[model samples]
Target: MATTNVREITIALRSDGEGLLNSLVDELSRLAQEAVNFMKRTAPKWRSTLTNSIRADKISDFEWDIGPGVEYAPAVEEGRAPGKGLPRWEDPAAADIVQWLATKVFAGRRRARRTSMKAVHENLELRDRYQGLAWHVRHHGIKAHPFAAPTLDMMERSFPARLELAARRYLATTGSGGAA
Candidate 1:
């Protein structure tokens, strides 16, 4: 089975005492959320499926997740093998044709009755349609378009500035002028 991949960033803070921990965690969470938002914008905007699936949440006082439980997200981020990344149809249209044929053409037929030529023709038509869809899918499989790694790269470049800003804001609010 395909699995979702999680990527995280860790930030460490040096504080003077226990009083600063809660404020630090809160500031870090806000920063992490900002990073996740940046990542979402950086994500490839095809069907917007993967991009929309991006999420951010705090895992602990010090840990945060930018993506979770997003199956197929890794495939979009890192690329996948041919025929491996396409979403499965919940109710395939081709399957519906087959089901209709079974119900309308074969449902009332007795063991002694042969299928009429019209039924055979309809079956062939449905088969052709199914084959065409299959052919298109097989020929054009999911192509890998990485988004996460590049987003992370960009974040790494700017994180120091962001962290500094967050720290400054924390200091301003707490009035702890360079103490912790």
Candidate 2:
């Protein structure tokens, strides 16, 4: 659902000349790769989760996908309302500690002797200690920290000159006389 809301940037070039197409494709691919690098560098450093999930794949000789794969990537990019996103454990080790305390220390007490394992698991106090921290974070959602948009902005500022330069180099190297 989050991915459906993802913003995409498409760069296209139309050339009528026959031999210029291959040069354009190569230049576009290079530009896409450069943009992907820019996005990855600009991505937030929190847990590096979003950054690590970023990918850039050439859909065709002309297109690329440059974004994160994680489901929450868009949520992080776009922000979310309080209580809207999935809860993420702040400390998995702490949850294990809480489970141990519930099953070992508390379960050994006389009053807890009559309690079933299911009842112990369902104990509100134990559940709260284990899950409450995560819930609290999700209840107040994180603010958006956009990476893709800024990367696109940077690319837009420089891509024309970069493309033109690449085209010039390609033509000069290939000794092509046609218009690019």
Candidate 3:
């Protein structure tokens, strides 16, 4: 199994007092929430599971780990290269793919078929769809549809502004309305 690590972004504050630190912490939390919301909107959704899995883990006073929570999250975010092989399901008939197959592809107008109760073999379209997907995944591999890394990129670009804003808030609260 290949791996995809979440992109890292850091915000550091070395304040001697709690007031400035509080401002920085609040700003980090806001940035983390923005990142999560951006990902939930931009990520490729699989019944909203992938999007809902996004969270922010507070790593320190000023840093956070923001990304998805699911196992196949990296795969969904980064996409699988060709020849990654099909999913190793013991029984394709009762595989988790039934619900996935039931979900409509977001980019299209196709109606979702009700395939939850039926076994793969019992439904011709379901069986064919699963097998076709399996074959394609095994051969062609999944194309990369990245969102997490790009989100970090976007946030990093605006980091200077965010940091300045935090500093300004701190200064305002302390009545030191000078340069950050």
Candidate 4:
């Protein structure tokens, strides 16, 4: 629910545009799902939690929200600024960092086959290493991954065409010729 990188677009409708949203609901839902999938694809695949948290929700009659469900979503998307203190939740032996270290540092090794990070987490030597890495992160801010931004850019570029398509579909369904 900690949404970030929020983008809003408003559509102006004619005075008598009653039920126009109903006609386009399916198309809009599809668009929202597409955006979620795009975000999932673009998100960094460290342990896959962030990517998996991506989802779409209908907030109002004409509003849809597509974003991640995790608390760290914003941090992952926008990154932390340099010199920002480590989050209170993240300690040196945090399961996530340990898992990431297992996945990254010893890639292609036997340890990679294990899913649980219990072994890595309990290892004192690895804990020290993760602590060092965490310390470094505190000093140097993480770079923005920009999954949401790119999706917004893609949506901006394709929105006009998509709206036209939806409008044409609606008009065709209602058999309304361009008389106005």
Candidate 5:
């Protein structure tokens, strides 16, 4: 089977004091909560499927580097350029790494799906909808928030119930005299 990949953003901080670990953990817990909240509003899949399942403890942190002698700017946009509406990154260097990771993740997902029989067998409309997500991630990357419509996770979580509900409705309308 072809491989699938996901990009996870990581950052590192060097601390000298004993209390630093506690401080860092506290901050990361806050960040995880923020991430969960963001997902709920932006990506409802998390709400319906993973709402109670997720917590700060479930988030894992790892070390990463901006590298030696690097000057970093925050991810937020600061000033606009003459032609560009908002600078892609306040810190160009870190942004470059994040973009690269996102690209790899997108490409890997597409390649894996292209090779999968299930992906090939789906009807055009369904395939298009699914593949469109792959392409969207490839081109624009997955948001920290859900900007796209309901995702695969959402569909998987809710579609079965939806399908069953529709089937019941259809049977109710048709009754026993309806076409077999």
Candidate 6:
């Protein structure tokens, strides 16, 4: 699932200070992963719906496609007289699953679109920050925010303060001030 683009993006995110930028990236990542996990969990129901919606004709050996609304055919009794001993029709769970998945699909698509928009806004903000940083550095060499003593101290302290210290170590190294 991991791609070269992921590495590139991580590298790009790290090439800056101001920890908030990294925090935005991390939030987006979490939303993307959660949407994917939700879809994966519902995938089996989708498959079952597709499979159960088909019908096979024995005489012509031709299969016919049917919608989920089709009810299961009842079994024919042989020479014995039918006395209503037949089992009750089994309730098809496919309809419920399909409906749930449809809802999920809509919700997932909406979430993805929202996430995309948020990322676009985040990118614009980062672009603005980079531009500002460049302007500051050009005007005043070895700027105040990049190597600020308090900021660096806070970045160093971030590790022991958080449970997932190792995973977050990359934040400080990336110049993300442990924020990203």
lDDT of 3: 0.71
Can you give the lDDT of residue 44 in candidate 1? 70
Model 6 Cα lDDT, one tens digit per residue, 1-180: 533456555665656434534554454344334333333332223335432432322232121221122332111001123232221113363344234434543454433343588666644654454445435444554312111233234435642344245335655676544443
Off by over 4 Å in 2: 1-19, 83-140, 174-180
Worst 10 residues of 6 by lDDT: 73-82
Q: Which ten residues in a row have the lowest lDDT in candidate 1?
A: 4-13
Residue-pair clashes per candidate, as listed?
0, 0, 1, 0, 0, 2
Better of 1 and 5 by lDDT: 1
lDDT of 2 by residue, 1-180 (tens): 223211221111232234456777878888887887888888876567778888888888767887888876676678767765343334564554355446654665554433677566556666565465446546886578888889889888998887777666665565442223
The C-alpha local distance difference test score for the whole of candidate 5 amounts to: 0.37
TM match of model 2 to true structure: 0.56
RMSD (Å) of each candidate, 1 decimal:
12.9, 12.7, 10.8, 10.1, 25.4, 31.7
- Name model 3 segments beyond 4 Å from true: 1-16, 88-94, 102-122
Which is the better candidate, 1 or 4, if ranked by TM-score? 4
Model 5 quality (TM-score): 0.23
Each candidate structure's TM-score, on Cα atoms with residue i matched to residue i, is 0.52, 0.56, 0.72, 0.72, 0.23, 0.19
Query: Mind giving the per-residue lDDT tens digits that candidate 3 earns over 75-119?
Result: 777787777666544476436675576453223544445675444
Model 2 CA RMSD to the hidden true structure, in angstroms: 12.7
Q: Write the per-residue lDDT of candidate 4 for residues 111-159, one digit (tens) a residue.
A: 4223566555546556577767767788887778889999999988986
* Prediction 1 TM-score vs. true: 0.52
Residue 129 in candidate 2, Cα distance off native in Å: 8.7
Score each candidate by Cα lDDT. Answer: 0.59, 0.65, 0.71, 0.71, 0.37, 0.38
